[model samples]
Target: MQSTKLVETRGLTKRYPGVLALNGVDFDLEAGEVHVLFGENGAGKSTLISMLAGANSPTEGTITLNGQALAFSSVADAQRAGIYTVFQEFSLIPTLTVAENIFLGWEPMRGPFVDHRAMRRRAHDMFEELDFPIDPTAITASLSRAQQQMVEITKAFHGDLSVLILDEPTASLTDREVDHLFGFIASLKERGVGIIYISHRIQEFQRIADRVTVLRDGARIGTVAMAETDEHALVEMMTGRAITEIYPQIAHTPGDVLATAEGLVTSGVSAASLEIRAGEVLGIAGLVGSGKSRLFRAMMGLAPRLGGKVTLKGQDVTRAPTRAILKAGMYYLSPDRKAEGLDLAKTSNDNLALNLVMGGTGVSRMGFINWKEVRAESARIADYVELHAGYRPKLVSQLSGGNQQKVLFGKCFGQEADIYVFDEPTVGVDMGTRSALYRLIQQLAEAGKAVVVISSDLPEVLNLSHRMLVLAHGRISAELSGDEMVEELVLKHFFDESGAKA
Candidate 1:
């Protein structure tokens, strides 16, 4: 007999005025198994799951639950049918408390009034069960991105779920939080719930996934058992090409120091010191709350530096404003792209033009912008970052995560800056996009520009950095170069207590 199928889709298709987002895709999930949808951004993974979660309706084909046809009119309808989805873009209201958002629609009621006490108690129990530390009374907006992610997961757990679809669930989670999430998924599997997982991290597939489905350009390429496939094969299936090296090796020819910080101190960072040189990649790595990003933010004047001396090309910029620092030939790319990098409501070309105008790159004259020159320059920068020409006229929010990241990366080329700092540059990007970004970093260094990369991804920093600094508890724990940047040694430094004391 055939194994139990929890959910199935046949000939699924979605189309818009000028695009076919998903095309005739067939997929299924078995009970108690993790079925991962693996693909590059814009490969129709999100479109397919959106349909499954009732966020969108398909133009063609049918969906079935337990061999019976079903149609959901809204996300609530899907939830009532025992299907819950944690989308990549959060759905929680920022102004509400965690408990309020968790039980927004289906609140516990007593007689004619909502029983808020019961709701908070239930939410607290769910968090305790999942081993997640979050206050039910806390305002949702005050939580970090990772904590908000846990809130989303906790909200889903409040429902009676037969199908749980998680879209890039661990994108903002730390290693310990990831472990808790994986354990929770294992428990869900034991309860015979079907899971549809979507993520760009290839290394995570082997840990929880039992089956894999690859999509490319809105069509399903193939499906295979996870046990039978390797990373190389999955990448080739997703990109339709071989990526021999995900990280490029470049010549590290260090020159004069372009930027330096001595005794850097911020609200999150303690006494940290480092140097960024021309023609080399400097990497900073640490765990969550380790102050890896804060150090650079303080040096760039984005954060309040309590005590520090920062210099750019021998000029003291310790108290310079952010605008002055940028005008002085230094650019910093924030890790939280949605909040700090791009304007979601604007077109990709418009965002790139904004950078050029800020850098005084002749895209504007006096008080008026030169639209023709801006478009031409934006197109050139788009090509350099491998952003599709078709996406230039569309809003940045309309693009996929990888393409949006490309737009942000392309902004760097629009300005004439000697120092480029990228924080968590490849957070939610696919392997192909990561490879492209890595090449761009390599090109920048070869052109004699100073490059600094701060990331929580240990492997990425290890492979890309010419010199690596490990941050622990807001201080530099260890600095390694050449043969000293191995995984074992770097991981040990991540928890070095000696670095914690000022």
Candidate 2:
């Protein structure tokens, strides 16, 4: 029996003014199958999908739907042809309600006036069918990121869906939310809907994907069955190098305690206590909303601390402002880099220099700016973070996810902070970038700096940290070191409600 080809692209190529975004890429999707697009950032995955979704026209290519050659001029044209794409960056209007955002352009109307009752009912029915718990009447802005993502996914169910493209759909979702999404995908597959799934999370491919296509430097590397290939092979193909070690081995030599949080309390955190010592990487692991990030955020004054005592080098700074804490030599790297870390409108060089200027470092003197010094120092920092010199002058928004993370990492070196806290530092980045960042963290710890890493990735925390803390129910459930940091033991403590030590 022959399966239908829902969509196909032959010799697809996209070219910009001076760069070839995608080159001679051949891809296809079959009905009732999940085809994954796996590659590093800037590997032509976005460009290929954009052309298929009619967001951009390829310089040269041929697209065929169900054996009929067609060219889509706009996103609406593709949508009309039963092709829907859920982009990574949300297109929802914050001011509008969930139902309104779902059916923005095509609204149910009662004689030119939108029928609010019918729209809400249809939205409710759609969510009920998908088993997604989201209030259709809730304002899009008021909902959590995970709920907003569900709204976006629900929008695809508005009309006849033949091809569904999901771009990093589970990036903001929790474990339970991800399970629900996977179940939904299973239903779609059973209905003979071809799905194109794009994600940097390789572990998910085995669960959801039937076939995986690897792209590199705007070229198609190869396509293989998901069951036949392993993570190491895929990583090597995407990075053109056999990575012997993803997490760098660092010497754990703990010195005097550099920072301590005694009885830290916040809206998300109950009572938590921890210490950051010099020349050690202290890893914090927990599920989403388990107070892993909240503990440090409250101590740094980013969030309100209901009650806590934060001391730096034996000096109390519990009531100090965030700026004061930063000035006192503590650098905190936010997980949400786009919103809280970097200015999208500013150039990478400018962002790094901004930190130096604020810290009154060599980039500025006596309330005056030094443009030449800023460029030199920013370039040095960029190189240190392995960011190419060509990207320094470009806006941070124009760079890929990995490069943008590199720019943010470079900003940390602007000021000589003794204590460094990284929250989900390698969230959306690729394997190669993760290796580079891990090496940089190792270097920092080896230099006698107090390093604290808070991550949702279990393997990341277990492999990198000399001492690992597991948080559960808004409190520290267990603190493990050496052999105690195994995956089984950590998983056991992740759900501990009594906050008892393992």
Candidate 3:
């Protein structure tokens, strides 16, 4: 049987000020095949898919589907051409029911009335096809992370899409949910739908993908048959590095207990307890809603707390406000940068200076703002992180993903906090920038600062953490150190009942 090309892009080029996100790159997908897209964050994978999905236009490129050139002036245009894309961030309407979200704008009508029954039935049918256990009538706001993703997939399935793009679909999914998704992809392939799967978990490529395309620095490195490659080779191609060493070695030892939490309780988890010492990197690993975020938020004083003792350097700060915690020389970098970390509409200098002003530094108390100090700080950190950009005062929204992340890190570094809480600091970031971040973190620990990293990436936690805690159902289930850092050993915590399961 001959393969049919479903989607193809040629000479794709996209430029944003100082960064060329995609430069003269080509990518092609075939019908009935799972095409795995691999890149080390900021390699233009998202940019290319956004162009194909009609979310954004390329500066230069030709996108053809089924041998016909297509121009997506809007997302509707792409949808009309049988293309669907599910971003890493869920785009479903939270207030709507699952059925309503699935058939949002293209509802089947029964003689001038919205056919609610028909839509629900169709939505249920879509779930049946994927064998996903999701209630069609459930409000999207009440669903779990994996359940919400199933709705997103069902929407695309019902759309009868010829090309389906899934970005990091398994990032928030449980092990069982991941298995279900892999099985669902096989069913999609049997139905002759061309699927593009993007994920950081290189292990999945072997199981689900037929061919793999690697992108690096906004260019196509190479494409190879999945049958002919291994994970090490794939890593080498995507990053252009041997990757013999995946994690950075922990150098600093744990010193005085910098922070401690006891009896922390939230809607997500209960009886949370943790401790971190100065110069130590402590890691919290768990599935979403397993209480990691809630614990961090409680410690930072963002969420409502119920019976908890939070101490910083043995000082009882259980009732401290978020500002008080920050004032006491502790800083938190949230996982969601666009929503919590940066003011996207503001200039880079303004974003960096807000930290200083919030802490009531000398620059604020002088009754006269010094623009040079702000500019100098931003410039110095920007240069240290190697963000090669013009000092033209650009909005953070105008910067690339890696540069935006650098700015976010810069804000926290300027605070000179004694204890740093980093929530997925390297999320959606490239490998080069990630390496730089690792070095920056190590240097911080070397300077006698305690760092707590809450991440879902197992390799990252094992690589940087001197001590690590695994949370299951909102409670600390396992603590691993030294020889217990291997992937299989750490993953056991994720699945184990009491560190006894495989």
What Cα-based lDDT does every candidate model obtain? 0.90, 0.90, 0.82
Off by over 4 Å in 1: 125-133, 157-159, 363-369, 500-502
Q: Which residue pairs does candidate 1 place in steric collision? A: none
Best by lDDT: 2
Off by over 4 Å in 2: 363-365
Tens digits of per-residue lDDT, candidate 3, 249-321, equal 6687678988888877777767777788898999888766567778888888998778878998788988999
Residues 1-502, candidate 2: write the lDDT tens digits: 9979999999999999999999999999999999999888889999999988989998998999998998999988898888999898988999999999998997999997999999999999999988889889999999987788888878877678899999998888888888888988999999999999999888898899999999999999999999899888998888887656777889989998999988888997877888899999999999987889889999889999898789988889999999999989999999999999999999999899998777766633456787788778888889999999889889999999999999999999988799999999999898878999999999999999989999988878888999988999898999899989999999999999999532
TM-score of each: 0.92, 0.96, 0.86
Candidate 3: regions farther than 4 A off: 9-21, 54-64, 67-74, 89-100, 131-148, 157-160, 172-176, 244-247, 263-273, 362-367, 499-502
Superposition TM-score, candidate 1 onto the true structure: 0.92
TM value for model 2 = 0.96
What is the C-alpha RMSD, rounded to one decimal, of candidate 2?
1.8
* Residue 379 Cα positional deviation in candidate 3, in Å, after optimal superposition: 2.3
